[model samples]
Target chain A: MYIIGELINGMYRNVREALAERDASAIKTLARRQVEAGADALDVNCGPLSKDPVQDMRWLVEAIQSEVAVPLCLDSTKQAVIEEGLKACRGKAIINSTTADTDKLDAYLALALKHRASLIALTVDKKGVPQDKERRLELAAFILERAAGAGLDAAELYLDPVLLPVNVAQNQLEDILRVIGDFKLLTTPAVKSVVGLSNISQGSKNRSIINRTFLVMAQAAGLEAAILDPLDQELMRSLITGALILNKAIYCDSYIEAYLKSKLKS
Target chain B: MAEELKMITTWSQAVCEMRLGAGRQEGGSRKVTLTVGGEETLPFLFKEGALPHTPLIAVEIFDVPQDDEPEALRRDLRGISKDPVTWAKAMVEDIGADLVCVKLAGIHPDGANTSAGQAVNLVTKILGAVDRPLIVLGCGEAGRDNEVLPLVSEATKGERLLFGDAVQENYKTLTAACIADGHNIIAESPIDVNIAKQLNILISDLGMPLDRIIINPTIGALGYGLEYAYSIMERARNAALSGDRMLAMPFICFVGQESWRAKEAKVPASESPAWGDQRERGIMWEVVTAMSCLQAGADILTMRHPQAIKIVKSEIQELMKKAQS
Candidate 1:
């Protein structure tokens, strides 16, 4: 599993204070910790409170890149902010998202090709996140069609079904799971799939348990990546166990420890 | 024109490379060192992946002569020398074995009951007599191996000997000794796949890296459950190529020990006239067992008869050749 650490975002209290004070050291330390905790990449977000989203995105990308060699996932709604983050990245960066809208697809694809970065496109168009599996797959197919037209390698694209909170949209959870697997069939050597795992536990009493359970279920459905808190030991262990059950990883008595050590080497 | 379909499977991981016997520049006395493993594809599918090294043959020598040893093997041993040092030298010099495997069977409680000091003295003498890379294995009894392996491992510290037969139930002491003395270990698992993986993990957990370990999947003689052993080895190679890190180490098979123990190899010609000459049949048995192991991903083969070693070694050269495509 490609785990993008979600702890570096400014939405967290410590990250918010670090962004306010422009404490690059705090951002650097968080980046290193996540990488040590087995994150394949880190998600750099400026949060909703950033007065200067473009500048803050660039700063976060630079700070994290300086501390760890892992790629940064430039998380932002605005194309300009993500583009700024991409320019500062010393290595390939991930464009957090775009929608199925033709205009947005055109803009993001151009940025992705120009920077040679992977793009994560959500299965949501101008109408907003779909509540059913069929609509979500339709949006994913549309995004992929645009990518093909632009001559983008299907492997460079990650499709997120935009999962809603289980507390409010309990009926849509199963549909989202199906959507994740269907995205792979949309192409040969199927397109990768990812999810912002915290979205499922939003407004839940037992957030950790809900998030862990959903992550494993999505993994069984062949989700390729996740933006999650790598420091969550129980959640990380569950992810490792899920991969083992799927035969994606070798089983050992100390498999979790083995995975962690392998991360350090790579 | 009809469209042709081509399917190519890609592997994300390859078996880890392990070098046996360190040379003078690397702080050991051996004149030769062999590097094994590092195959990205299954054995000899060169069109798919690189096979960096050919499989090796290690002639097995016992510290003490076996009373029940078949006459075919006894004839071969009589031509050479039964003494450990002279036998190791003849195996390397005359027999042309790529490596020498000294089986310290005399140290077993049921056998001559030799002391650890005697085993260590014999290992050091053989290391001096033969400059080839060495593989030192203990008696099958875990209790005695646990006692004898540490002393022998410490005696040949920088020689980089491959000490083994460390099983799931008794690996802690041998693994620690190998680690402390800077030697490689052979992890023995019965025909079961899960136990093979588990033993490797247990050995590695004691601060021993996976690259310094080889898996002994415990094979059977040809026609004596060889197909079952073949399946396990093939499954292990498939798992390794499919990215199972713990199962990715190179395999070592004791072809001579298993093949010779079969009644078919030991019966006299007068007893079974239809079975043909006992010596030739026994040699062919070892050769056939060794050949099957090579195809099933054996990086190292331990054999007894000189004629069988020559046949298996020549066959390895033939199999290592890649197709023109």
Candidate 2:
């Protein structure tokens, strides 16, 4: 289970506040806690709300990397932020995403290949998020092909079959899983599947529980990387257990040990 | 040389892996851990594949009966009938039930007219009194069940509680709660294999693991339509063993609900002398119904009568031993 700690994102009130004040201490604390809790990577997201989004992303990448040895996942909608974050990161980072859009795909793939960074590809194109599995899988394949065309290894691509909120469309749950499972079959052994873990449980009460359950189920369906809040003990436990059960993490005797050593720093 | 039998179906892949026990140290506070969905082959076929864990048995504890129960049950349960907490405790402590399934009959509109908070309190009392894993059930009233399950789930977080009758229309709240609370859910559909499969798919889509789900394909009493339920369960097991991941979870049955509701178990001795002793007859009715379902594919049986539960437990032990050998 490759946990991309989602704590550095500017979504939460605390994180947004920290970003606004440029509180490096707050940012470092969040990053260290996620690493101690079990995140393999810290996802640094500087949203458009920031005055200098690229410079803020660069500052976040540098601060988080300085505090923790774990890799960084450069998360941003803007290509400039991605470029800055990638440059600030010490080692190879995961490009938070690219869509099936031709221009964005070309730009994101070029940056990822140049930086020798992995990429998270959303299964959506110019129109919007696909409503069916076939379309999502088609979009994912296109992204994979485009990445390959850019001279990036297939293994570097992580497909995100975007999860639709259940409140909006109740029937979309299975459709997303079908897309992931079929994508697993369609892609080569080198390719990996990932998802924004919290999206499935968004808008529903008890988001943590739903998010944890979705993580386990998605892991069982062959999702290797998950963009998630790694500081959550329950979520970390579920991910570690799911990984062990699925034979993804063979070293740990039990989920407890797996989590303690891999996710928990202490 | 012995005759060579040709195999009709060839399964080369592993169907379902046995679920590890989920409880307190594993983030759940329950004393006994639940191990579900460890079928290497399908529901039952010891010769074909591995069935690691024995199907769990849960004793039913209702809030209060709508009407007078059968004389046999009335005799044993008369003392605790007034209070659900005492009744649930009696089922666990006295009856030696493996699991206590607390049915919130009070939540049903025609019953106590209890609010969701009352249901939550009752479930909390049951959880506090008993150390065993719980299966909190509703009166099968959709509106009431949907209302109560979420409250119950929130109140008993990390207990690994199993909740039920999550139908298509109102599973969101309950399923979401189960996910949040680290509990399990029962996806109930009519006794049709296809409907069962579809419901499982729907719940799984919500991100509930296959192991956390228990499929209730509805149930039938012995003289009513046991064969239909049995056939459907068998088919479901077949589909699971054949690598259909959707139908892989353990099967749960409303044994007591179905058997007690049937005419054979409810009617008095005076009305049916040919049925033998009413106590013996009613016990036999529940026992037979549960046994038949277990043989077909039921992995969890919620039973009523103590005598019937004893018989079913012994039979399960025998089957488990036979499978082990």
Candidate 3:
């Protein structure tokens, strides 16, 4: 599993305070910790607290990278903010998302190609998050079509089924999983899939269990990457075990340690 | 809608590439060295991955002469059976062995019980006689091996020999000696996959670089648990290609040692004429066993009979030839 650490996002109090205060050390610590905790990349988001999202995105990207040299997922709803983050990134970056909306996808695909970055395309548009599998697959197909039209490499695109909170959208969870698997069949070299993992437990009790369970199920459905908390030891353990069960990892007596070492080497 | 179907699968990692011997330029006297592993896909799926090295054959010669023997082997090795140096020479110069494995069998408590000094002296002579790289193995007795291997490891210090049969219960002394003397060690495990990986880890934990170690996932002769051994090897190779570094080392199968021990290989035509010519049956037994091992991802095969070795070598050449696309 490709783990993109979500702890660096401004939704967390520490991250929000650090971004507001321009404290490089605080942001650097989170970046270093996430990588050590087996994160393949870090997600940098300058949440609602930022007065100047673009500059803060650049500063956060620069600060975190100066401490640890891992790829950053430039997370923001706006294309311009994501563009700024991409500029400050020294390594390949992942654009946290674009919607199925044709205009937005065209822009994101062009921007991704321009910077040689990966873009996460969510199965959402003006119609809002799909309540069923067909709509999600339709939106996913639309994004793939636009990406192909723009000459984007399918490998550089990640399709997310727009995971919704389980408490409110309980009936749609199964459809989301089927769509995740369905997206693979629509292209030659299938586009990769990822999810904002924590969204599964939003406003729910027993959040960690729900998130861990959902992550494993999604992994079985071929989710290749996920935006998640690597520091959550239980969730990370489940991810490692899930990969092992899927034969994506080899079993050793200390497989968890082996997984972490292999992750670090790559 | 009818659509074209495609099978798109790929492995993210390849087995670690390892070199067995060193030359004068690299501080060893051998004229040739063998490199193995580096398969990015399953055995012989040439279209999917690069198989940079072909499977190699090593002829096994013991430190002591064999008096009590199988007629099939004694008939072939009549004169050379009494001396290790001649045996090593014939294996490399005549039999065309890619490498030679010197089994210090006499050092075992049940055998001649040869002293460590005697074993080291025999190894040094074999090293001098053959220009090919050597694989030095200790007697099966752990206590004697512990006492003997380090001395031989020191005496042949820079030869870059592949030494082994280091098991789960005892690996430290040899691992340390190999590290000090700059030789590679073989980590052996029973048929269990977890134990095999654990042994690799234990050996690596003692500061031995993983690539320098080979895995000896123990095998049985054909018709005697060969399928089980094949399954274990398949699982290990698959795991290695799936990004498991600890299990990613190349495999070494003892085709001759196990194959010759089978009852079918030993029983003569006089006793079981229905089994056909004894020598031909024995050679075929070894060949079939080696081929199965190679198909199941064996990188190095330690075999005995020259006829069997000749057949397997040609078959390997045929398999290594990828079709032009």
Candidate 4:
């Protein structure tokens, strides 16, 4: 139920326009809404698409932190973007990524250690997103080893198994969940796990419905964090309810107060 | 009397565990949260073992004109039907609903030709007007949902919303937004047990928790293949309870959509004498679908029709009572 409000990213046309025009109002609106809605952290992704990702991510992070108290999940594939995002972050932030690839892992882990930022590790290596759970687990194990060598705490590491669309491979989903279930046995107990929420519903009709249902299932499989849009009420409610059932929260009693406050601010 | 009862053989459990509530002391807002797992003790085993949580019932509200709806139900929603916000508000205030499920049918590419921003604005308006938990449903169009959900996610941000109808294809953008924005997701598969399990697996592949996922095995109305869906969900739940981790998340059924779409719910009274009164039939249609889903292991049932909601809620109360006793 740790909602990471994803509105500040520059991927959408509106956000892109706002970022390009330096429209602080639009950016501020998104930031405030996400915080109010229920996002625990705001993921700031100033990808290469932005004019200056480093500077833009830094500015976006600062702007969001000023208005909302939620932590930031700094997202970028570039080492430079991770560095700048880390530098700009006010409190402890989450590095949006690192791959199992040795070279990439070396760089990203260094940055995470340097800034004491939590890391989102992708279970993919020199080969792109794996097609099966075995490969995913192999890569995840490799990444975990490298992370351990780098002296990163298990709790600070979040593993992303990489959800592939079912249309491509019917069994692809089964493989992925198997890996998640196996991760409990494979990795240390303290290690956290998460996923980029969009991958499973790729190319399907009724995408939102499919995405939300899968998110609930993933939560069942022990996924802790998700890279998703924090604004959808249906998705948010599912997250709240799902977290309560999992006993992830204090006493499973915060629904009414939290929901009301979210609406009031909105 | 001293003889030990033998354990009954059952299908292997395949349900997954889903977690809710992220970043509390770890740094976000919100004092408390909850998560439900997809696990089942043995599909519909109310008498045999513990059913940790009772199924939740959600009331459905649509953004489209219901000219086709029966006069009885329409009368109750006369003024509200004109506006989505009013209708949603009524679902909460007048209907005693647990969750408000707003279907953005008007924004589908095939329907209103609305833009993503328009859909976002409509959802925002509705959210602004209600305090209860919300479930935003997209028209079952993959491309259109991708177009609208991200914006909707951006618009709602952090309300801990549940967005849906995510299928095997076209889930990336919306799923990404849900993950980024900290919302829950619904993984919908065709009415097949394997397919349901597969979708859950794929979503978890992205590092999303099973607790954050809800499985929709695809619903069917009373006669239009209800038994098929029922059996499939039953099998899936049995698998979860039997220890299969993939199918463990709580189940959701689009009762309103499935039941309302049937000919029985839509056809006029004169046209089908065998069906009897259209209002009674329609309400029964929804109630029967909702009840069947509950029997098959539905954690949350999204329904239309006030009568249907009332009946299902009471039925759920009775079931809970029996279980507690």
Candidate 5:
């Protein structure tokens, strides 16, 4: 599974203050912690609250790259901010988001092609987030068509079905779960699927439990990647256990320990 | 539109190479050395990965004469079997066996009851008889093998001899001796992956690096549960390639011993007219067992019959050439 550590963002208190005071150490610490917790990449967002997102994106990219060698998920709603973040990335990066709207999809598709970076496209279009599996598939078709038109293969595309808070959209969870497997069949080599792991329990009382439960269930539904808080010990352990259960990795007596040791190295 | 069908090239993380025998400068008195393992993919899969070293064959020559031995085994070595040294020389000079496996059956208490000192003397004479690498095997008895094999291991201290029959109960003694004597070990398990892994874990716990240890997940001849043996070996190889360090070493199969034990190899034509000639049937039994094991990733095959060994050796040559490109 591909894990994008969702910790270094302006929405978080520490990251917010770090960006305000230009404290690179704070960003570095968060970057190091997530990578140590088995994050294949770190999702960095300037948040909607940033007065100058392009500059903040550049600074966040440089700070995280300076501290850790992992790839950065250049996350932003603005095309310019994502472009600026891409410029500062030293290695392969993931463009955090593009929705299914024609103009938005076209711009991100061009950037993805030029930078040769993977893209994570949300199922919601300009009309708004889909509430049913059919609408989700419709948006997915548009995004995948636009991506392929620009010569981006299935491997370079990650389709997210736009997770919503479980307390409000309880029925949508099943809808998303039902379509996760179908997402893989949409292309020849199989397009990758990811979910914003914490979105399911955004306001729930049992946040950690809900997140861990949904992550494993999503995995069984062919969700091969996630934007999650890697530092959540229970959630990370659950991910490893789920992988073993899926027969994705060979099991040994010391499998968890072995997994962590290899994670630390990578 | 015509879609071109292309093959996929997958790779294993690592393939460890095990060297047997030491020359003058390295340690042994042999004129040449033998190497096995170091294959990156499934055996004989040229499209997938590498076949670094061709599988080596060592002829099994026993220390004592077998008056009641199977007729097929006794046919060629009948007279030479009187002495270990003569039989060993014949295997290397006549049959061109890569190495001579000296099975010290005479030392087993259940049979000849030969002393450990006598076993050492036989090994010394056999080493002098041939310039090829020698593998010293123990009788199946655990207590007796543990006792005699270590002494034999110590006697051939610098030859880097690959000694075996190191079962779960008897591995510590042999591993410790190999650690001290600068030789190698063959850890034998009873055709089970768990026991095979446990045996490897035990040997590794004794500070014997895996590269110095070859695994013998016991075999079953064709029509004699050979599939069970194949399945166990395939799983071990897969686990090893996926980073199970304990199982990443080379594998050795006792083809001659297991194949000859089957009734079909020696079943009388009078009893079953369709069974065919005893000699040809027996040789084919060993050949098929070796070939099936090779496909399942055996790095070394030890056989008793000269004709079977010759066939397997030439097959290994052709296989290696076909896989190189």
Candidate 6:
């Protein structure tokens, strides 16, 4: 699985204070730990606490990249903040993300093409998260059609079926799983799929158990990547176990050890 | 509504291209050099990536006459098996091999126990007899191999030859020799991708260039753990294409060595009447092994039988045609 470490975002208390105090070392520490935890990439977000998200995003990118070589996923609803973060990112940066809206997709596609970066496009539109598989597939089709019409390779595109809190969006969770599998048929060469794992268990009791269950089930439903806390030992173990069960990894008596070592391959 | 169906593709980062055998001005004296690696995707996955080069075949020739206990195994090379020079000559002039492999089996203490001088002489004779690029392999013993393989490597300096089976336990001497001699090295691992990659990482950490490395993931003949070997090579090759430099060198499989050793290939037809003629059965045995290795992304197949080599060459031609021009 392509794991993106989701710890550097300002939504967290430590990251929020780090952003306020302009702590580069704090950000670097998180970056190193996540990378050490086997994150293929790091997600950087200024969150709502930043007065100037563009400045904060740039600092996060440079601070993390200054110490580590892994790619950074620039997380922001604003395309300009993502673009500014891209300018600061030394290597390839993932633009996370855009919805099925045409204008939003056109702008993000242009930025992705100009920067030669991969994109995470959510299966959402002006109508918000779809409640059924057909609607989700339709929005996914729109993203693929527009991305392709814009000359982006499907491989370069990663489609996300928006994951909402299980406490509030229980009815739509099944549709999310179904859409993840059917999304492959929406385009040729199959657009990759990723999910923000924490979104599943937000505001729910037994969050770790809920999150792990959703991750494994989503993986079985064909999720190729995920935005999650690699520091969460149980979650990462479940992800590794799910991958083994899916035959993505060759079996060995010491497969967990092997996977841990090779997961560091970026 | 009717619509046209099209298969799109994903762009995989290409594997490194490794050049073997430096000619006169460059260093070696081979009439024709060979190159491998440089695949952008899994083997023959045309829609996903480009297969830049078809796998090359290097027929194996030993320095001293090997045991030919089974009369059926030596029937094809009865006269040629007696001398390294004659066998190598027939390998290039008659078999149409892409390259030649000289095994210093005689240098092993268990056998002819030939000295370094004798091993060097045999190597010189084969090099003189065949102008194709050469791959020189040592015996199975690491300690003994460490002793003589270096001398042969030094004697054949500037030939840009490919040296064999550098394992984790015995790579330092050979890697240094390869670097100093201006030749390539093949890092061999048991049928395990992790060990295969770890060996490459160790070799590359020696500060020698990675392009001079080839991977021998080890071979198991058909019906003899072939799938295990195939998966190891495939996974390692996939990792290489996926941008892991340590796992990315073109793979070299000892196809002929492993295939011809199988009981199915050595036993007589009368022993198993259900099986076909022993000669044809043995030939098919090697062909199937070589062909399977080709499918698993072997960049160099060191084969034995001339007829098996011919069939494999033709099959590779047909398989490669499926790639986009």
Sort by DockQ, top down from the best: 3, 1, 5, 6, 2, 4
**Docking class for candidate 5:** incorrect
What is every candidate's C-alpha DockQ against the true complex, given to 2 decimals? 0.39, 0.02, 0.55, 0.01, 0.16, 0.10
Q: By TM-score, how accurate is candidate 4? A: 0.51
Off by over 4 Å in 2: A1-266, B1-22, B42-44
Residue pair clashes in candidate 1? none
Per-residue alpha-carbon lDDT of candidate 6 for residues B1-325, written as tens digits (9 for 90 to 100)? 2232265445445777888777888867887877898888877777666788988999888877777635555878889888878888887788788888888888788888888888877888788878878899888788888888889889989988899879878899999998888889988888888777777767766866878988889889998889999988878776666545667678898888888889998888788888879998888898999889888888999988888888888888887887755
- Share of real interface contacts recovered by each model? 0.19, 0.00, 0.62, 0.00, 0.04, 0.00
If you score just chain A, what TM-score does every candidate get?
0.98, 0.93, 0.98, 0.90, 0.98, 0.97
iRMSD (Å), candidate 4 = 14.4
- Per-residue lDDT tens digits for candidate 5, residues A51-81, read 9999999999999999999888999888899
Question: Least lDDT summed over 10 consecutive residues: which range in candidate 6 chain A?
Answer: A249-258
Tell me the TM-score of model 3.
0.90
Candidate 4 lDDT, B36-74, residue by residue in tens: 543336534544555666667667777777556666567
Candidate 1 residue runs with Cα over 4 Å from true position: B1-6, B323-325
Model 1 clashes, total count: 0
lDDT tens per residue, model 3, A180-226: 88999999878899999999899999999999999999999999999
Q: Which pairs of residues collide in model 5?
A: B22-B28
How many residue pairs collide in each prediction?
A: 0, 6, 0, 135, 1, 1
Leading candidate by DockQ: 3
User: Model 4's CAPRI class?
Assistant: incorrect
Lowest-sum lDDT 10-residue window in model 2 chain B? B12-21
Predicted complex 1: CAPRI docking category: acceptable
Candidate 2: residue pairs that collide: A37-A263, A38-A263, A209-B179, A209-B180, B18-B38, B24-B28
C-alpha displacement of B231 in model 4, angstroms?
Answer: 1.1
Q: Distance from true position, residue B252, model 6, in Å?
A: 3.0
Q: What is the TM-score of chain A in candidate 3?
A: 0.98
Q: Give the local distance difference test score of model 1.
A: 0.89
- Per-residue CA lDDT of model 2 for B1-98, tens digit only, reads 22333443456334343242256667755776656556766445666667777876799887766575778888867778668788778777776668
Task: Estimate, for each residue in B57-117, the C-alpha lDDT of model 3 and write its tens digit.
Answer: 9999888876656788888988886898998899778878899999999999999998988
RMSD, every candidate, angstroms: 2.7, 14.9, 3.7, 18.6, 4.7, 6.0
iRMS of each prediction in angstroms?
2.7, 15.0, 1.6, 14.4, 3.9, 4.9
